[model samples]
Target: MKNNFFYGYSKQADLPEKKRLLFTEFMKNNVKINQADSATLLTGVLAPPAAMAAKKAGESLPQLKMIKNVPDVLFVPSATVVALITVRFSKRLFMRN
Candidate 1:
């Protein structure tokens, strides 16, 4: 159990059920986003399985709303892919000047 990825969370049986469910739901929804360092700053590192357990326990996790992609020229080479990406860069450029 100690070796589990969510050992700390699993051991948190003393936590209030509502708070625990929220944490778990947060994890389940943001698991992929939290993989990035920047995303971690925004989201957090939570345990998805813990959230699943909460769901199984009859707690409903609210839908997690996360941006589909972060508009960075480095990751998105083509500015045409998303007009927002171009707009974002333009805003930055204008601000810098």
Candidate 2:
């Protein structure tokens, strides 16, 4: 029942044999950031801002100028969704072994 914070497990014996082996294997492996993961992280970080900028640019065109309050109408909810996605992605990205 001991809490081993250093190794991130409560007790080795409490874990099932299969899980214990998997945990040990995971701990033994070297943790390196995957390039694809880095790319996904970068895209997540940049996407919202890039979308906003593009939306603004599109709004500035004469034909597109008829639409007003696009930020309030579109970007607000989209930004919220993007923010939520980024938060979730960041948690996964940072928690990866």
- In Å, residue 97's CA in model 2 sits off its true spot by 28
Q: Tell me the TM-score of model 2.
A: 0.35
Candidate 1 stretches greater than 4 Å from native? 1-7, 13-80
Residue-level lDDT of model 2, residues 1-97, one tens digit each, is 7544446544555668856776766666746654555555676667677777767777888887855556555775586577667766777888895
For all predicted structures, in order, the TM-scores are 0.26, 0.35
lDDT of 1 by residue, 27-48 (tens): 7866875233342322222323
Candidate 2 lDDT trough over 10 residues, lowest sum: 3-12
Deviating ranges (above 4 Å) for candidate 2: 1-36, 76-97
Count of backbone collisions in candidate 2: 0
lDDT of each prediction vs. the true structure? Answer: 0.45, 0.66
Model 2 Cα shift for residue 26 (angstroms): 18
